[model samples]
Target chain A: MSDADRVKVPRPVARFDDVTRRFDGGLVALDRVSLSVHEGEFVSVVGPSGCGKSTLLSLLAGLTAPDAGRVWRRDARPGEVGMVFQEATLMPWADVRANVMLPLTLLGEPRGACARRADEALARVGLDGFAHARPFELSGGMRMRAAIARALVTRPRLLLLDEPFGALDEMTREAMNDQLLDLWASSGLTCVFVTHSLYEAVYLSTRVVLMSPRPGRIQAEHRVDWPYPRGEAFRADPSFTHLRSALSVRLREDAVTPEGGAGP
Target chain B: MNGASGRAYLRWLAPLALAVAVVVLWEVLVHVFAVPVYRLPAPSAIALALYDGHSTLLESAWHTLSLALIAFVLAVAGGILLAIAFTRSRLVEAALYPYAVVLQVTPVVAIAPLILIWVGLDNAPLAVVILAWVVAFFPVLSNMTLGLRAVDPGLRALFRLYGAGAWQELRLLRLPASLPYLLSAMKVSAGLSLVGVVVAEFVAGAGTSPGLAWRILEAGNRLQTPRMFAALVLLAAIGVALFIALSCLERRVLSRWHESRR
Candidate 1:
């Protein structure tokens, strides 16, 4: 099926109620932060560095529990979760296929099944032929591609991404953004991605959530009413420019806030 | 590059040539000095002595080598057990460890006489040989334990999170990591084992079912200098052979998984 036809199947998803997470010894990392992610939605969370954005993704991935908060997969959707860490974090000693197949291996899935799924995922990330190569052999962008492939191989109901391309060069980052958009659109996966990139947030996201600092809370949300299966043409559009500028202004305001009290 | 390669060749060839040259010189020097055949024997004279007394020399070598082998095994086994107990409980390490240290540091020369006196005759010297084994063992056991315990806490936590039990983690990861340290200890201890065997033999040889040390002394008393040198050469050969064998063993076992092999 063509990419345009793929985005129509899985409708958007949302989470009800707030998420509050507090650490021991009276440190609150998240305070009543609530966000909804519809199926086939490409949402970006743009905020100050310690805005509990990554923590929010971690909670969605079931990696960390939120104190006094409940998370949901939204009714009527078959649920599965995938997470990509900020760093590629591929197993150094293992090759790309082996690294991507780790979760499947851990889950005790047969080697042949994991191999096929891994190959398909690698192809989805445009990394089909680089399967047997070790992580050290790959460049930064390729490593992140492998990490993304690993996350997507499970074909989960929800995809949680935290700055997956933050370490790449500008050229590579833009290319990865297009690829990710294509993947999300075609797979109809709900993605709640955390990023500090204003242009990336505005360009790739269907909805953008700007967050405030310490005991992180949502500051603002913007919806991008653009066509799906976006390409380089969309990146040049006036609407993209306007959204980026507005998001930049809010981020700057949060940054210069003297109290430094709202984020992280 | 030429110099380095030549130097590498010279490292082996030079020593071998020197050995041959020394034998020739000794053979010629005795005739030139008119040194009494008894007082300062020539290389030929020692060869003659060995030929004449071949049975006795070979028998003594067997005795000494067997003693060294047996004592070395006992020392390694007992020391490893003691080390495990010591490492497991800090209080035990603190408690019974003074003796391990005393055993390691105290000169075998001083203790051989006492050990001989306490154990008295029959196998006392063999027991003394085991003292050398004990001396050789602690460094390996201590170093290996340290290496085993030195696994990264991050990896440890990851393995724990993955549900790897203690034995599985140790067998799969900890043991391999600690191997280099253990092999290094074995290299030193292998040489030490030979030294311990000889020293124990030297002190205890005069008393009874003697080893090569007694043969050396008996030959020396009769001014059988070549015989004495022959025995020393045999002992040196044994030590070299043991060292090489152990080094090969260490390399073979570790090369499969370790950086050293790579």
Candidate 2:
């Protein structure tokens, strides 16, 4: 598409308006955080460990309610939004197919349909022939792949991932990132990815959001301004380096600041 | 035999050889010391007694086995259902859990007479089964309760995210997660049930039908030392057999997933 066409705004798939969340000890996790993700967009939220990035995804997934303000989504029904946590979280007792089939199974779908969808999902994540294999038999990356397959099996419109590749080694993580982008591009699913890695944010997202810790709030948003199907060559591009360095510097500034203090 | 088969052969042979050697030594010592048969019967004498009273002894063995097995099945069913109740409601667990512990800590020997009295001496078999169930059910209840609560938080969150209802959560997630704990508890219960049956039979005296324990008591009264030894041997064999069978079932159920099976 031309720049003119790309500049047109799409419909919002999900929105968070002045959302505030607190923990049991009254620690503010996110304060007055607002974000809007557009249809077919890849939005990556980057922050330090305590920046409420995970809590943000939790809100979108409807696993947690915002203590204040409103979180809205176009499709809020069950199976409309898929979530993947940092850990694969596949049931140890179940085989890959059964684990992937869980969402449909819970919805009371027919057994044959559940199995077929589960197998198709497994194949999508390159886990064909691994349907019958136990989760214990998979390697770390393969286990995460199975988790992603499970998340995708529901064919959700909106995908919320909370550092799903964080535990993986650098090489495996990069490969997964590429695979995730491929899935997103092919499926046209809106994605909101949360990660600590600036390189990952820049490489995979259409918009990279940086958050400040100590009651997390959106500090900055950078548009990647790059075309789709970004490959290995894009990583070496000067634009990619510049954006990554900017995010790194911004993150360091936010990290060193004390609670209730301003960054220099 | 090849090396792998040779190792397997040795594994089987070692235990068998030790048992045979012990029996032979006991027989020889009894003969050499001229130990009176009433005090300790020779292995050969015990064997002969077992043969001579095979019909009566086998019938008694079957009675004890069936009683223990029935108690075991009841304990398993009751324990799991109670555990599910405990998981679904905190109030039920808080109210009833202490009593379960009380039942466990109280000795079966102390309560067998009370059970017999309550169940009535006329229904001695039912009382015996009830006593056995009391002894055997606690391990399964406590373990399953813990297992249900010990679910992975992430998995729990995932299930909730998918909007799984309470029954679906139990059926798809909690029940399967608790299988290993349940199986291990079953192993412990299997042995405890047998012990409970023996103790209950002893307390019941001749009021109940003749079980192996009853046979042993009768043999003791008459100074039939070989018969007592023979009954004791059968009881030990049953205990070992029950433990082995439950262990095999555990391996079968858990081999695909559990670390203990590996």
Candidate 3:
């Protein structure tokens, strides 16, 4: 396809126009969900626990389907949806290299072809010399790294993360967020990061979509203006603090009062 | 209590001292009690019996070893085949597994004569002896199957994502995972196979292929207590040799990967 035919950057597209997702017992997980994510955009969706945050990812990855409406992506092909689950989903029996190489192998690439790429992917994730180490040998943070490597090995255009570091300690999670940001900036890949932490959402996303509880609906959306080359200082900014507190207030109101007031 | 010496090597002392003490106690007890040679022979008398009956004992020992070898091979073949079938599905495991348990649980002595009759073919008597070999074979298979499937789910998923087929998964992951279980099972089966051969001798006495079991029987009938003890010790020796060999193999293979090696 010609350059003109291709969609523009920062206009990277995820289409979920009028999407409605209903479970078996008429539990609506998503209602009329319409959102678009531009190319190379970092988007985080936050909600209370059991708010179908994971279900959104599942829909995007085609692991499950939306009950109504479409989730269409023009830039990414079907095979390019790389998903990282909440758990460190690395294969415990597989060494680091083999675990990362999994997507390539699943795509039916030859072993000789994937071998060096697998090593490179591991090295890229800071698991350079530990290529032969099993998942059990690695720490929780390291194992999550291996999991991320597996997702990136395929060079996916659209990455879907479902609370990827929710289980990690605060310090490790911060380190991971920086690493993830660096990777995202370097690779120029669009990401949909699902998180429960308001600070994390504000910290990582260029666009933050706050979701309301059970029968989930998007309560509001905010465009984060924190400049990139975003350092620890950006997190300490008054603007960052105000945005976080505002988002938390909106989330609290959405749950307890079942009413969403207009933003100031 | 938790000193470095607490983890000190315990090499050979326990067994060596136990053997020496047992021999010394046997000598003193027999001398003090004046136990007749026809009843329980002293260790020295048994040693003498071993010295005198060297040629005959060697012959019978060889016979017994050969029988046990053949029976063990049969058991291994049968066990491995059944194990493969069992691991394939819950249905196959349920159907074929129970009969194996029946084969094991039935007393060898009571069934030996009946097995001798039922063979109705050449080496039928030998076959009856081999029947005892079938006992405990599946324990190895059962344990091995458990080990093979015991791989972590995440690991299994990794393999799947790599597009590894069933054969590759089995060859690389399943079989290697099952090695410890297989080795332990081999240890148990090895000891049992030896016992099976000797028991067969008790049933099919004084035949051309009659083993140490026949010698044991003959010595007992003739009031040759020392000869009986000598044969028992030799059997014990064979069992020890096989057990030690299997243990070495287990250690050698696992030491590189397993922490228990240290």
Candidate 4:
């Protein structure tokens, strides 16, 4: 491509500088890991288990400080960022509306404002009718949607998702992928998704990052220049499967190392 | 649905039927054998005693019930506050938790005389309430501590991500999450508070306001076994009432959220 036709890179929203993390049992999670996510980019991290993919997201979300390196962000304060965990991570005592209001309430926002924001968020996730339902009373997919609504209530500029849809079946997972993309497009939020599925990473990410086994280090980075509003047909495209296979090969190579992958 | 309702009816009816049968059998045996009133009062004689000594028994019961309730309220408040303190600071927990354990392990009856002497006769009920509070406090403290610590790590991380301060964390997350544990502890302490107050009253000896325990002792000393039996019935009723009340509260609070209640 000519220099004039080259893609423009957005300013980095977050940067990790050689972050290292170690546990008490002499387990190294991340070692000298360096990466950056640009503004409004959908970055998916795919790796084998125990490869510190979740740890990277945690650092970016500022849930845990790195043991060694610095995690730099673009002036994102606590309420300016949102997170969705693997499980819903909802308070069982609270209903859907109350759960969505959690972040705003914690910020000590006025009740009327918090309630309005929560209602708006729930409606955005298509969960308006289920706002009064308890978390346990909802189906798994519905619960996850509520969780996403909770993550979005703060109107966060950055959203961190750790395997947010890993538990859903294929159909539901695909539907959620579309929904997530719609949400991401409309809000223009920077997102970092951690997952084990290569297809999922290829399907949703503007860029896919691969990491090696334990003491996770960034192995490779691939960019997908697919246009916005990618439909179901994209999953059937030869290019989609081609990219997934390339990413899968990178994962398998590290998974079957001299020492087997992380224990079940 | 009809079968389920039948089963529910039986659940209540079975115990009541057995209690009636036992009372009937006891009455028959006492009347047939002509057992001494002091040794074992007949069910009819006990019923008569209940009717005759209604005022005295009720007044003493009210005193004991009020004391136990006061202690229970105090215990809930103190235990929850201490538990919050413990969760916030490990240093405070490390220094004070052992002493709380000591208080729990020490027998209230053994210390009742000293408590009465220290607090004086006019405030004997207060001393009894304090003793009941000691018995009731540990369960709440320990349960609340466990509940606070048992918060899901994922949820805790989410709270931290939102910049929830310690106080907000406790109020919005820890306290609500710990409701089941706290309720269960309250149920346990409800019974223990009654036991502590009765034992303390017995140890405190007869003050101006004789509580249920003191009345029971007076009846036993006078060989009014029927009156003593009536007093025992009142004590049992109080315990059952408190247990049922707390259990209902627990169910009402937790049925919507807690798996156990559901």
Candidate 5:
């Protein structure tokens, strides 16, 4: 879509307005970062290591507060936000069903209702038969599926994923990417995904936000105009390759040009 | 037999064979050297003593076992409760944890005589149980506190995002996360409790209805060396039995998820 059309987008379901976050020992994790994620938008934040990508997601998830500026969530309600970490983070002692049921259980839902909801969430994530299996009994991808099932069980409006596929093999990562897109599409859930892989950002996101390290700030934003249900054909398309390479070149330039007062 | 089962068989057989060899050699050497029965009795003589005093020995064993079991249950319950309190309030932990460490390092033997006197000879069994509980409480407290605090940061954040209250987090996450640590601590404390009971009985003298340690002391005074050896044998058997039982419990609890079980 043209820039003119982009300006016509509706109100954001979640937004960060000129936000800044600082850690202990005077480290600036983010600096005046403004981003907005509208309902049903698949937005990916891409940055190198130590580039405040996670801090961005953490702020959006309300896991951490910004040092300055405003974090707004439209119609914020209990259990309205779900987060998936880089690791599966499943309770080693709990079975998949119990793990998925945890949010509802904590909310004081009835036992029968929690069980039915957990089973439904498991089925949504294609984990129907593995509800009774322990976390250790699952493969890497399957364990991550269990984690997603857990996050999705609460039926949150917005999902924040922090490099959820980083630990998976390449083939498994691609499969999970496709599955995540399907989940996002069918559920009408807004997603703010963080990753370092430009290819992944380009393949899965409606808009890619590039961040630079050393007091992280948004360096660029690219609108991906690819149609929905993007598949292997999109990966082989010349436009996909051009956009990915252009992002890579911009990232390389940022890496070479060191910011003053930033440590090596 | 297949290799795995053959290896399992050998694991049991080797220890049994070694024990039998040691006993037979002891019996043979006592006979060959003509050692006085007062100094070192033959295995057969000790066995005869055990058979002759079977009723008395069994009674003493039962008394000691009961004291140890009571003390063990109290230690586990008290330790876990204290650990939960510590996790909930940093001020409580800071105020009380040093005293716990001091209690652990003071040596139960040094305090047993004082404990016996304070509790009075009329309540000697209670004194023994108290001493044993003191000895067995520290491992569970320290290990469980560490385990409760060792929750994965991601999981902690998830719990927070889901708005789990303190009690819910403890029941669903902290308590289950700390189980492997608690079970291992229980194993260590089990052995310590048995040791504590025997030492406390020794210090409490014959006032506590003649536990095995008292039987050992009584036999020593009369120069019934075989009976003393029999008492020692029973004590060793009790210790081994407790360890094996605890190990089996640990296996049952941790076999599904714990890395140590694997």
Candidate 6:
């Protein structure tokens, strides 16, 4: 199809139309948040610690439903959507391959096919040689890589990651960012990543949506026009620094407001 | 073969040495005090009794062991199935868990006579198995229930995200997570099953079948203290064997990832 035809096609991988979620005791986790993610887009959500980024991902995963407004998922079914938690969340009793095979096994795929797909996923995550190793035997980063493999093994069209590298050190996090970018480039998956790091958001996301605290609502959306295969040089680039500081200033302004509210 | 085996050898050898010392001291005390055989038999006398009554004691031991094994198998099935039911349904658990607690707290000795009358004398061993099952069932149920509910929240959410069915969740996630708990409870129940069988046998008396407990009672009535000690030794041996066997099984299943095994 031509670019115009593709543009005319009403295809949205996910759409949040004025969604609001309120907890039992009147804590509003999200309020009137609206966003749309297209196919193969990398969207990063950045906010303060309690700004409902994880909750947004959970809503998208269908683990939780929005209390008000419509959340539309037009891309894939639950089994075709993959998610990574803040923690690695691996089954320690199972080895790397078995952990990665979990989704396929639950899907009732044949054993040999599950094993083959798990192997491929593990290899994609650079864990080919460690397929038989137990989760506890692997390092933290390796464990997270195994978890990523598990998410990818189902061949999901949409991948949701909730602060997956939050616990890692700076060096490992940077390496994982590059690895994740490479995977995204190859797989063409529409990814929604939630993180607190502005630098990470600028480095990895096509569009970064800033969220405000205390009833998380979209504050501002920043579009990063950086080209693919952005290397360490992009991190040192003046534009990268300027964007990071700009987002950081907005977050600082949000923090200074005494009522746990956001500035316009 | 070298240092590790040498250390392992010493580990058991130390306990064996202590047991030998205790036996020698008991022998010396009996001989020096000229104690009557009726009151307390010497280790030598117990050994001789074992030799003389080997066939009868062995037969009785086998009878008791068979009953315990039957009870153990039944208890395992009942406990695991019931625990699964409890985890799956709040209504079932609310209605029935109290009765399970009653079974746990009520002594098997207090119920063995009733079981005997209910099962009849022809099925005395079967009666013993029921009582043994009562004693052995609760640990597995409680431990497994806790294990099933103890699944990591994040992992549980992942399972939910994949839209895994209830059976799939149990089989692929809950069951594997609970193996450590189940194995630990099984180890505890192994010895309890044997004890329950023996106690039930004692209460039921020597009806249509004889067991090691009956042998002990008969020997005691006849004032054959040495023979009584031999029967007691056989019972202790069975308990030890059950414990060792179950422990080996637990280690095999749990050494990979369980914190306790590690």
- After superposing candidate 5 on the true structure, give the runs of residues whose Cα lies further than 4 Å from its correct spot: A1-8, A259-264, B259-262
Chain A, candidate 5, TM-score of 0.94
lDDT for B108 in candidate 6 is 86
Chain A only TM-scores, each candidate in turn = 0.89, 0.95, 0.92, 0.94, 0.94, 0.95
Global CA lDDT of candidate 6, please?
Answer: 0.91
Lowest summed lDDT over 10 consecutive residues: which window, candidate 2 chain B? B253-262
lDDT of 3 at A137: 78
TM-score of 5: 0.96
Predictions: Cα RMSD each? 7.5, 2.9, 5.5, 2.5, 2.5, 2.8
TM-score of 6: 0.93
Residues A1-264 of candidate 2: C-alpha lDDT, one tens digit per residue: 677776696889899999999977999999999999999999999999889999999998899999999999999988999989999999988899999999999878899999999999999999999999998889999999999999999999999899999899999999999999999999989999999999999999999999988888899999998898998889999999988997899888777766436534
User: What would the per-residue lDDT of candidate 5 be over residues B12-78, giving only the tens digit for each residue?
Assistant: 9999999999999999999999999999999999999999999999999999999999999999999
How does each model score on TM-score? Answer: 0.61, 0.93, 0.77, 0.95, 0.96, 0.93
lDDT (CA) per prediction: 0.75, 0.92, 0.79, 0.91, 0.91, 0.91
Better of 1 and 3 by lDDT: 3
Report residue A28 deviation for candidate 1 (angstroms). Answer: 1.5
Clash number for every model? 10, 0, 3, 0, 0, 0
Report, to 2 decimal places, the DockQ of model 5: 0.75
State the lDDT at B110 in candidate 5.
Answer: 93
Model 6 residue B50 CA deviation (Å) reads 1.6
Candidate 4 structure lDDT? 0.91
Residue-level lDDT for B106 in candidate 6:
91
Worst 10 residues of 6 chain A by lDDT: A255-264
Give the number of the best model, judged by TM-score. Answer: 5
Per-residue lDDT for A61 in model 5?
83
C-alpha RMSD in Å of predicted model 3 compared with the true structure? 5.5
Higher-TM-score candidate among 2 and 3? 2
Task: Give the alpha carbon lDDT tens digit for every residue of A1-264 in model 4.
Answer: 555444564778899998998766869889999999998899999998888999899888987788999899995687888999999988998999999999999888999999999999999999998878998898888899999999999999899999999899989899898999999999989999999998888999999999986778899999998888888788889999998998888778877773654555
